[model samples]
Target: MVFDIGIVSNKKILLVDDEEDIVNLLETVLRKEGFKNIIKAKNGIESIELCKREKPDLIVLDIMLPDIDGFLVCQEIRKFSTSPILFLSAKDEETDKILGLGIGGDDYVTKPFSPKEVAYRIKAYFRRHQIGSGKQTSYSIGNLSINEETGEVYKNRNHVILTAKEFQLLLMFCKNPNRILSKNLLYEAIWKEDYLSNENTVMVHIRHLREKIEDTPSKPKFIRTVRGLGYKLVTQENI
Candidate 1:
């Protein structure tokens, strides 16, 4: 996919991996793809420090690092920044994928991946952010309010912090209220990938979103499961 080079060049990208060769290869590819402001970190501690200092627009992280694993690094980073994190790891286990996404990762690309594909994914994420930013709409359902322009969410006038993916999920529901969103549809839409019958990814994110926005996640009032159908965000009128 061709990206607007002028826009892409300005976004700062952080590449974190203990392997020197992997980091170099990714940096080369990203630079070739018009990403100019690339930062490199070889370990989890350095990655964390750079993340705090640089405040990158996105991060490509590897799970197995020298100081701490990528999962812990991701947890720490999520406490402050909502920048998109793409996990690049050799661990292809389903549990690891779930854990990565559950802890606040936006995408997971296993090792032995194509550099061009990774570059394309990064471009796609930036494109999504651009499109999302162009929106100035705000919606309020019950006590929850979302400002798409600022990417801010509020619950009962109290500020609610959300991961980037979680906020996108809520925004998707808010856009299509009272409509059933099947797991496959949601997986395709939010993950920006084909649905591989991996329902857990969507389920985990939805559970997390409920925890943040619902009065009682156990008996969710807004995002309700339609059992065999899928899930729906119940509007105020429906409630």
Candidate 2:
């Protein structure tokens, strides 16, 4: 049971896939759902360019691409933007799915998936971010601002360009603030129902995010490694 009752009509989405049929079908489905701004990129390289130009609210990315693999593209995308990423790959392995999420994707939709199901999940994700007389998506720590609705993040009134995965990782930290989030916790939250996974996926994104937002990534102020505990976000110095 999904409803777009409070949703804005002009939402934007980026659909990235090498397969034309899949892109066309998903584009059609998104158009029918009231997303007026739907952009398309056939491969990972093109996807990066589209991201720089359009800055879509969400992205539908395939795991496999003709030029570059989806994971690598995801890593690179994490460098500049933090939009929500939903893997649209055909690989159905638990490890793969987990790996995608762990890297920066908010959700994973297997190939041959129902358009309606994808729509439903998208709706749910949107609802989760809507700030009204309901669940609020905006989060802040010190000068950082995170909008869960659009998956947009900012710091000190400045738009912090974070890759989709970096944004995801930031959101998890901001929500908990001082809680020491274990690597496993992070890995699982991003990649629900993993189809494949490797430890490097999470490590790479973490390093990238630190470089972008931290005053001294080597000596982080916002996101800190808790030695044996993992990572946490704190506004003030640990006393």
lDDT on C-alpha atoms for all candidate structures: 0.91, 0.76
Mind giving the per-residue lDDT tens digits that candidate 1 earns over 71-143?
9999999888888899999978999999999988989999899999999999988877775336589999999
| lDDT of candidate model 1 versus the reference | 0.91
Q: Write the per-residue lDDT of candidate 2 for residues 1-239, one digit (tens) a residue.
A: 34455363556788888888888887788778777778899888899999988888788889889999888888788777767888888888877876776666767788889987887666666665555554556887777778877666676788777755577688888778888987878877754435244465667678878877876889878888888778888867768
- For model 1, what is the error of residue 232's alpha carbon versus the real structure, in angstroms, after optimal superposition? 0.9
User: Model 1, 163: alpha-carbon shift in Å?
Assistant: 2.2
Native-to-model Cα distance after best TM-score fit, residue 165 in candidate 2, in Å: 6.5
Q: Which ranges in model 1 have alpha carbons more than 4 Å from their true place?
A: 1-3, 132-135, 237-239
**TM-score for each model:** 0.93, 0.65
